[model samples]
Target: MSNTSRDAVLARIRQGLAAGPAPLPPRPDFAAPVHPPLNNPDIVVAFAESFQRVGGEFYYCESLEQLAVQLAAFQERQQVGPPYVWESDLQAVLQAAGIEFLADEADFIANADLSLTSCEALVARTGSVLVSAATESGRRLSIYPDQHLVLARPSQVVAEIGDALRVMQERYGAQQLPSMVSLTTGPSRTADIEKTLVLGAHGPRRIALFLLEEEENNG
Candidate 1:
């Protein structure tokens, strides 16, 4: 086409576009649903039921000494020498009780029979334990071992995932957030092979939680 004809066509197209309907108004943001705060009993019950449904074992310990006794009994039944533990108060307790724990040896850790680690928070809504690379367990300790044991206090339990995340945020400020966060619900399982359910397909076959409850001081 000639230059004059092309310019006339472009002008007509622009004029037609300008005469079209105005753009639609922006949609209003939806209001979020409100939920009431959950009581401690409700949260604990929810966590227990959810965890059990997903093939997790739960134990209630009155104190660290009781936890140690239960752990010792478990170790004897499993016939394992010592578990791989992170640097924490639990380790000290075990040591004091003459229960050995392997140091941070990467090679040995992968082959260890069990791993004991501390979690940042427990989500009652999902029955999940929140962990992070910032903790002593890191990543491999929770995943590589054949069995996993978690030591959590009653105070660490939260009503939902949001509360658990908030705990992490407050513990480690925005600038010092951990490299990774893991929310583990239960023992690893898979139904990928011919729809046959198999446990420990990718991770530990067993997971046990020892919930330590301390007495409140009346004073």
Candidate 2:
């Protein structure tokens, strides 16, 4: 074959090799059950247990006030210095506990040692904090800080992943929704080296959850 033809043949072979196999579509997330776990004792226990299995601490309180108090105490014990953050009404909760609310600015997340966020829904089964982008304050405060404190009510606790999706749909219409919806299960953790669990490798090392009983009343 002439030099030009030989080059063309090699190019064709290269193209064939590069073609390879078609890309596979990503696996879809498994959907949770559609039914809510409201007033279900058995479901509640199971949900709480699952959270514990995932290295999360769960608590049931009489009221949101008590939960807030517990959170304050926990913060003190954990040595989480603040400049704490509350989305809106969370200010009242933290203020009552004497934790100052840091103002939101460019340096807000970088400067603050801890953050307190009140979320709309909690997936108890997964111990995930559901944060919609619609709540700008909550989203920023939760992810940016070194330690995240989430206040969730039992009423706000949904049974499974599907239930959370329903709540999100209700909060933000099907068409229009915030760009980010984070299902944060726990503090950022990794076991990169010799398989030893290392906390805070990616983000916050500590995540304290306050399962406020009366979410509406607290707000």
Top candidate, metric TM-score: 1
Per-model CA lDDT versus the true structure? 0.80, 0.70
TM-score versus the correct structure, for each prediction? 0.75, 0.70
Cα displacement (Å) at residue 106, model 1: 7.4
Instruction: For model 1, give the 10-residue run with minimal summed lDDT.
Output: 32-41
Q: Against the hidden true structure, what lDDT does model 1 obtain?
A: 0.80
Clashes in model 2: which pairs?
none
- Name the best candidate (by lDDT): 1
Clash tally, candidates in order = 0, 0
lDDT of 1 by residue, 102-171 (tens): 8677667447788888889888877898888987778877888889888777788888888898888899
